[model samples]
Target: MFNIPASNIAHIIQLAVAPVFLLAGIGGILNVVATRLARVVDRVRSLERDLPEADPDQLEVGMRELAILDRRMGVCHWSIALSTVAALLICLVVMILFITDLVALNFAIPVSLLFIAAMVSLTLGLSLFLFEVTIATRFVRVDEQYIMRRRLL
Candidate 1:
């Protein structure tokens, strides 16, 4: 018969908190990238609309920058998506391990499993958050501003 102490439970809770930090960090980074991309897109669109008759050389430069930004954004999105999936899988595995450990009445196993789960979950959440906050939201805002600016001009 294995009796788990309250302190152990507390420890687990603490471990669980690790994910929040990871998520926040990842979100921050993603947000920055997204914002920059959005700005670039906006600039390209603005140039296209407001300066339709501008010199071909200037137009070409804007188009090139837009293309590069688009490619980068796409790569970032896919990378984040893949990482999130992997993290989820790791979390799932940890859950399974915990369950198995519990069934066996192996305190050590469950504790280890929980620890792993917490770590994996934290990583996944952080990565997803980063991508959403840094890249995705910024991109949208930039695009919106660009469109509005072009319209007004």
Candidate 2:
């Protein structure tokens, strides 16, 4: 009810603060990973659109790059998905913190579990992001022209 004592209210707010900040950090991570996923999808779509009538050599090279892009996209998708789940779990933990204090029940175990789950999900998401980055590196086109200019000088 609305009869929460001022000190209890202050303590509850204090307990909630850390989780709220964690939620904010998770939100930022989710935003970045989601943007990366969207870019991957966009690249795949562009490649698919152009693959149909490409010249023979272009088709071969394009298909190879497309395959790599597909793998990269899969990892990106997983990263985004896991980050989303982590964000959800973090939100749940924050809610549970409030509810436990309000109802006079022990929240230690459940809140810990939820926080751990969120961390695991976030870790996996970041790992996928790392894997995708390495995959992306495989397809990056370096500026040979720039290097050649240095050689010529």
Candidate 3:
């Protein structure tokens, strides 16, 4: 029931603006990953500095484990970053298509349906990414458990 003209260029402008939202979302995810990695690196450095020098072999083993943990976290961080970028790109494409359809039909029933679908897809993707980040933070708890066990022995 929208009265916007089929030939209106406002839809094109809206489509162009939609990518900014996608970029912002991607940037947010990257920022979270970067912050998390920095904290992990800082914790590892602290462990290295604080560890006692009494047992060289034990220290070496601890350092090796820390290195492995760092590598694994780095891989995960990169993987999340890449997926965020990819999802953002996909959302941008979908937004463009939704806007194109809206313009062609002047916001008719089919265009409204497409718009709803696009919004739902974007929301679901964002939610899943958030869940992944939450789960990833549990890795810190695992590291803490290892530290506790080491202290016990």
Candidate 4:
């Protein structure tokens, strides 16, 4: 109802601020994960398009790289999913903050649990991002020219 005190409302707003900031951070993470996923898809499409014209050795190397890219694409997908879940959980935390203030019910346990789950989900998503990057760097083939130049140094 409309009987809630202004000071209580202000306090609720104060409680909500942290979760809102957490939501913004999650949004940024989602953007990066989505961009990586798109890039991986683009690379996969490009490789598929050129596969028919590739010579045998080129085809073999391309196929191998394509497999690695495919794994990267999957990892990016899972990371995005988990990051999205975290963002959604943070949103729930914010809403629950307001609801608890308005209805005068204790939601502290639920809010704490939600925030913890959000952090766990975000951590797992970031770990997957790190794993994806590791896989990508592992398969990166330095140009022979670059290696020869380094050797000359």
- Which candidate wins on TM-score? 4
- Rank order (by TM-score, best first): 4, 2, 1, 3
User: Which pairs in model 3 have colliding backbones?
Assistant: none
Model 1, 20-49: lDDT tens digits are 455565456555545654665676577668
Write the residue-wise lDDT of candidate 2 on 65-110 in tens digits. Answer: 8888888878888988898898899889878888888888998998
Ranking by lDDT: 4, 2, 3, 1
Candidate 4 or 2, higher lDDT: 4
Compose the digit string of candidate 3's lDDT tens values, residues 1-153.
Answer: 287676555665566566566667766766666666676677777777766763888787777658765775655565465646555555656565666565554544554464455456555545654654665565445567788999999
Best by lDDT: 4
Candidate 2: which stretches are off by over 4 Å?
150-153
Candidate 4 per-residue lDDT over residues 1-153, each given as its tens digit = 698889999998999898888888888888888998899899999999999999999999999989999999999999999999999999999999999889989999999999999999999999999999899888896999999999999
Could you tell which candidate, 2 or 4, scores higher by TM-score? 4
* Alpha carbon lDDT of each predicted model: 0.56, 0.86, 0.60, 0.92
Off by over 4 Å in 1: 1-5, 79-153
Could you report the Cα RMSD, in angstroms, for every candidate shown?
9.1, 1.8, 8.0, 1.4
Per-prediction TM-score = 0.46, 0.89, 0.46, 0.94
Task: Indicate the TM-score of model 1.
Answer: 0.46
| Cα displacement (Å) at residue 59, model 4 | 1.0
